[model samples]
Target: SLSLSLYRAAMKGPGLFSDIGKKGRDLLEKDYNYDQKLTVSTRTASGLGLTTNAVKKGGLYVGDITTQFKYGETTIDVKVDTESKVTSTVTRAELFPCTKAMTTFKNSDLNYGKLEVQYFHDHASVTGAVTLKQPPNVDISGTLGSHGIVFGAEAGFDSVLGTFTKYNAGLSLKKSQTIVSLQLVDKGDMLRASYVHHLDGKQTSAAVGEITRK
Candidate 1:
């Protein structure tokens, strides 16, 4: 049901193989009398920053194929569905030097585009992103953490007004077997909290939230 392997490469870096990266699952009714669903997927990664994933699924026959590939700082994704007769593709690239800064660019067949930049220091990171096409949008986020606690905040800015239009903040804490998180969002005036507990290598989680805006 599961398999894994590791091998050395001459110039492409180390390679790893595992069913953990690619998997297939089938779900049936409680009585196991009829086929309910099926899925097949595969993913691979190497030390040289090469990664790939492919998936196909349907009730009884494979109907679609989706694949993703990443080499070094560039990525490409594609999807094809036989049932719907639809195909889509997207490409992305990222760059980061020895410094604590990174930048990314993304584009899709639908003419969608985005750019992102991030900077990190010690236990903190800041990020900014913008849409590159019409109906432009921008967002900024920052996170700081130390010990067992992490705090983060994000805001969205209106492209035309150049003013913040949305804001959110969150906090997370972890200790031993328990983890807790809280988040607040401005648009819907929402507040959410979640708790997770780990027991004997298993995890159980619960979440509660509320929205005040109609």
Candidate 2:
């Protein structure tokens, strides 16, 4: 009955506690608000750079400007440079419904861009990403399980080189606070094995071994 009265009071204004109710509602609405920042740096003869950043609820936007204002030898020698980027991320219900997923998109004026999508449930997750540019690239990676045995792999293609520039796979076995991992890269051209054991709160022991192609 108390909560019902409070809800009714919050819904209807022009009362003694209406201002408190209005402030509470406003705070809840702006719970995930964002902020903006600006930074400026100048170096003798090097140039001056100003960076601006905005972090939204689930996204980030950045811009940069560089110019030689004080070091230019002549009026025609002065140069100004500018860069801008916008990145955003959405998760699960924010982008869609029901699915446990997250997606990120980023774009920059410097011919750089990226999109990544991931789906995670329980202790397993899968991620896929694409880079946009002259040499566009795509990568896929995933991990499974948290205890006992966990494994993940990542592979990518480089359009510029017309080859797979990224290739890595790893498996980890964990029990208690001890873990052993084996990883390979470049189709077995490189191999690494490591073991890590956690002692007390301030101590740990680890060993690593590696083998490389000749």
Candidate 3:
């Protein structure tokens, strides 16, 4: 997933540079006499707020090939002569990222979006990330009821990154600023429920419920 995100970022930014890279790759393949190999594997598990039995292994190999590319005012020949594979099984708590910089952008008419990069704690490790996207706010909804008192319908924008979410709007039902409950509903052809809660810190509660399906 991270690799995919980086792929997208590269495509969106520095379009000319990316095109040059592709052309260079084509040129290299056309003239260079070399082959390469790469492989990676991983497994992970987390429990008790701690990581357990996490591991990763990867390696790379390439034959001799003098490659050069344009980088500012300098030329470089990056050749992977040899490589080795190693495995690491460390706890998640010990695996910390070296988040060096994060550039946040304020709302503006020009639409210069937000960007962030996080380095790794490992001296030889690095990972770059950026969320360069913003979707438009488009809402379309409709509701209908036959009763004379029927007057329930609602729609709104929502986003959840850390926890859970719910959406429920009805005329007869008493709306609330904070309402938490487990519900089982089968109305028309849909089955859904919306619960609400504002749980403050350092608080405990005891509640139980059963789940059923049709």
Point to the candidate with the largest TM-score: 1
Name the regions of candidate 1 deviating beyond 4 angstroms.
1-35, 42-63, 69-75, 82-95, 98-109, 161-163, 202-214
Residue-level lDDT of model 3, residues 1-214, one tens digit each, is 0111111121221121112112223432444433333333332232112112212223543333223333332222233222322221111111223112222223222353423232222111122333334532212222232221122222223232332122333322112323222222233233223333324433232222222345
TM-score attained by model 3: 0.17
Residue 181 alpha-carbon offset, candidate 3, angstroms? 3.4
Runs in model 2 lying further than 4 Å from the true structure: 1-109, 201-214
For 1-214, candidate 1 gives per-residue lDDT tens digits of 1111111112121111111001111111122433344456667654222222223334335445656666664545555554444443333333223222222222223455556555555566666777766788887777777675778787898888878898887777767766566667665488655555545455443222222332
Give the alpha carbon lDDT tens digit for every residue of 24-75 in model 2.
2333354454455455655554444333333333365544443333223211
* Candidate 3, lDDT over the whole model: 0.26
Candidate order (lDDT): 1, 2, 3
Reference-based lDDT, residue 80, model 3: 28
The alpha-carbon root-mean-square deviation between model 3 and the true structure, to one decimal in Å, is 22.1
lDDT of each: 0.49, 0.47, 0.26
